[model samples]
Target: MKIVVAGATGSLGTQVVEAVRAAGHEPVSISRETGVDLISGVGLTEALRGASAIIDASATSSTSTKASIEFFTTVTRNLLAAERAAGVPHHVAISIIGAAKVNANYYAGKAAQEEILRAEPDGWSLLRTTQFHEFARQLVGHGKLGPFQGVPQMRSQPVAATEVAAELVAIASGDPRGIEPELAGPQEEKMSDLVRRYLAATGQRRPVIELSIPGAWGRGMRDGSLLPKAGTRRGRQTFDEWLATQSR
Candidate 1:
């Protein structure tokens, strides 16, 4: 089977591409490096020419709500439109856990993507997962304010991106089943603590300050909203473990 992986150059997308190969399927990668502009719809139809399924693992780095929403919605619309023209059967999307409840800058965009996918009467699977173990690394200096860094007041159960990729590949291999069970890490850890520990492991001496965000988004972060719910799938690697490996 030929699987087209959108955002093939991203962190999770790269792993998804590898998982596709490991699963004994051909992966057609779509990214700027490969001449495909997801938002612009350039090279999309041709990319999906012979694909059995297309996994949208793409993401945007913009923190602006408008930009994030535009990027996700545009990309999703373009992919679905091209898939219809190319006769691609399955459209697999990766989303964040509690995206609907949390209208935070980035989560709002994810929720918008989910809304679009749910309306489409095609073969599509939406996988919602918590933050990845690498998320802490990504947020190390996220709120850097001179000598003290501000960590968001949140709790996260982060799974390994590798595990998420394998699960997504497995889902794309079979028929679409709508939304799948949420996937998360083995345990929950405070985001501030995780960032602090990460800094220490990397031998970077910086004071970590927890920022109390306001509004529903902040509530969602501080509360258990970001944590995985009952029956949510779990992964083995702990944040400490991922950090330890990084320090080595």
Candidate 2:
């Protein structure tokens, strides 16, 4: 089987590509590096040719609601159009847990992506997962404010990207199951605690300030909307376990 992995160079996409190959499938890499512009449809049709399935892990860094919505809508539209043209059978999408429940800009985009997938006339599957263990490190970088590092007051069960990748490959190889079971980490952890642990492991001495972001998005994060529901699949690696493997 041949699988087309959009955003193949991304954090999750890279693992998805390797997992597809490990499962005895050829993974066609699609990214700017691979000459595939998903939003513009450039190189996309050629990449999808002869492909059995497409795993869309593509993403953007924009935090603006309008920009995020436009980016996802365009990317998903192009991918689906190419898939339709190529006669591709399955389209597997990775989305964040509680995307529909939150009012954040990024989550709005994700929700739009899922909605588009749902309306596709072809076979598609949506896998919603919680935050990755890497979120802690991302917070460390984004939360910096002079000498004090800000940690949002939220709760999350952060799964490993590798684990999520493996599950995505398995889905792409099998029949499409619309809205599959959610995936989460082994246990829940506070956002501030995760950041603190990450900083400590890296020998950073900056003061960690816990902040309460205002709005529905913030409420959802602090009120357990981001946590996985019961019976959801849980990843094996805990935050501490994953943190131990990171380079100092």
Candidate 3:
């Protein structure tokens, strides 16, 4: 199987690409570094040519509402169109769990991506997974004041990125299962607690203060609206297990 991996250089993307190769498939690395920009549709057709499946792990760090929505929407549409034209059989997209429920700007972008993919005529599988364990680091670094880091008051089942990538590859290599089971970690945890544990393990002394996000999105996050419902498949690793690996 020939697999086209968008965002091939990212943390999760890198793992997906490696997993694909390890599964005895050819992985075409697609990203700006490889002259393929899904946002602008640059080199997309060529990159997807002769590919049997596409795993979209692309992402941006932008927080601006307009930019985030635009980026995800445009990239998703471009990828779907290209996959259709290229006669790709399976299109697998990774989305955050509770994207629609959260209603945050970033989650809004992901919701848009999901909508676009779901509407595609080609076979598509959208796997919505909970936050990665590394999200603890993202929370601490996404915003920083002079003396404190802003951590949202939220609950999550943070899975390992490698585990997420493994599932993605399994989906890509097999038949497309539309809107498959939601994936989550083994245990529920608070964002603040995970960050505190991560900091302690890393020997960093940054004070983390929880703030109530001032929107429906924030409320949803803090209220556990984004958690995976019962019957969802759970990953084996816990946040603590993922954190422990960092010290190794």
Candidate 4:
């Protein structure tokens, strides 16, 4: 089977591409590096040519609700249109768990993406997963305030990206199951603690300040809205286990 991985150069998209290749399929990468502009639809038709399926792992880092919504909406519409034109039967999208329940800007965009995919004329499959274990590292990188790092006081089940990628590939290899089971880590964890541990592992001596953001989004984070529900599939790697490997 020939699989086209949208945003193939991204964090999760790279893993999906490798997973598809490991599954003995031809993995076609679509990204800016590959000359594919998902939002503008430039080079999309050419990139998707001869593709059997499309796994949309493309995403934006914008936290603005409007920007995020526009990004997902445009990209999804372009991909679906291209899929229809190319006669691609399977369209798999990677989404976030509890995106609908959360009030964050990014979640709003993800929720919009889900709505769009659900109504897709060509049909689609959606996989909702929790934050990746790398979330801690990302926070450290992005949440810096001078010499101190601010970590959100939130609960999370951080799954391994590789595990999520394997599941996505397995889904794409088979038939489309609209909204597959959610994937999460083995146990619940505190986002602040994860950040502290990450800093320690990297030998960074910055003070870690735990922040309790006040809002529905903050409440959802501190609460368990982002956690996986019952009957959801769990990954094997815990944050501690994943952290151990990261220290190498």
TM-score of each: 0.94, 0.94, 0.94, 0.95
What are the clash counts of all predictions, listed in order? 0, 0, 0, 0
Per-residue lDDT tens digits for candidate 3, residues 1-248, read 99999999987899899999888999999989999888788799998999989999999898656777898999888888898899898989999888876656788888778888777665999888999988888777675767887788998988888989889989988888888788998889999889888888988888888988878778878888878898889999888878878972
Which sections of candidate 4 miss by over 4 Å?
Answer: none
lDDT (0 to 1) per candidate: 0.89, 0.90, 0.86, 0.88
User: What overall lDDT, based on C-alpha atoms, would model 2 receive against the true structure?
Assistant: 0.90
Task: Evaluate model 1: give its lDDT.
Answer: 0.89
What ranking of all candidate models by lDDT puts the best one first? 2, 1, 4, 3
* Candidate no. 4 TM-score: 0.95
For candidate 1, write residues 1-248 as lDDT tens digits.
99999999987999999999999999999899999999888888889998889999999888677998999999999999999899999999999898778876888899899999999876899999999877777777467889988888998898988899999999999999998988999998899898888888888888998988887778888998888887777999888878877852
For model 3 the TM-score comes to 0.94
Instruction: Give the runs in model 1 whose Cα sits over 4 Å from its true position.
Output: none
* Lowest summed lDDT window (length 10), candidate 3: 138-147
Q: Per-residue lDDT of 52-83 in model 2, one digit per residue for the tens?
A: 99999889978677888898989988887888
For residues 116-178, what per-residue lDDT tens digits would candidate 4 score against the true structure? 988865467899999999889878878998989998888998999999999988988888779
Candidate 1 vs candidate 2, lDDT winner: 2
Between candidates 2 and 4, the lDDT winner: 2
Candidate 3 whole-model C-alpha lDDT, 0 to 1: 0.86
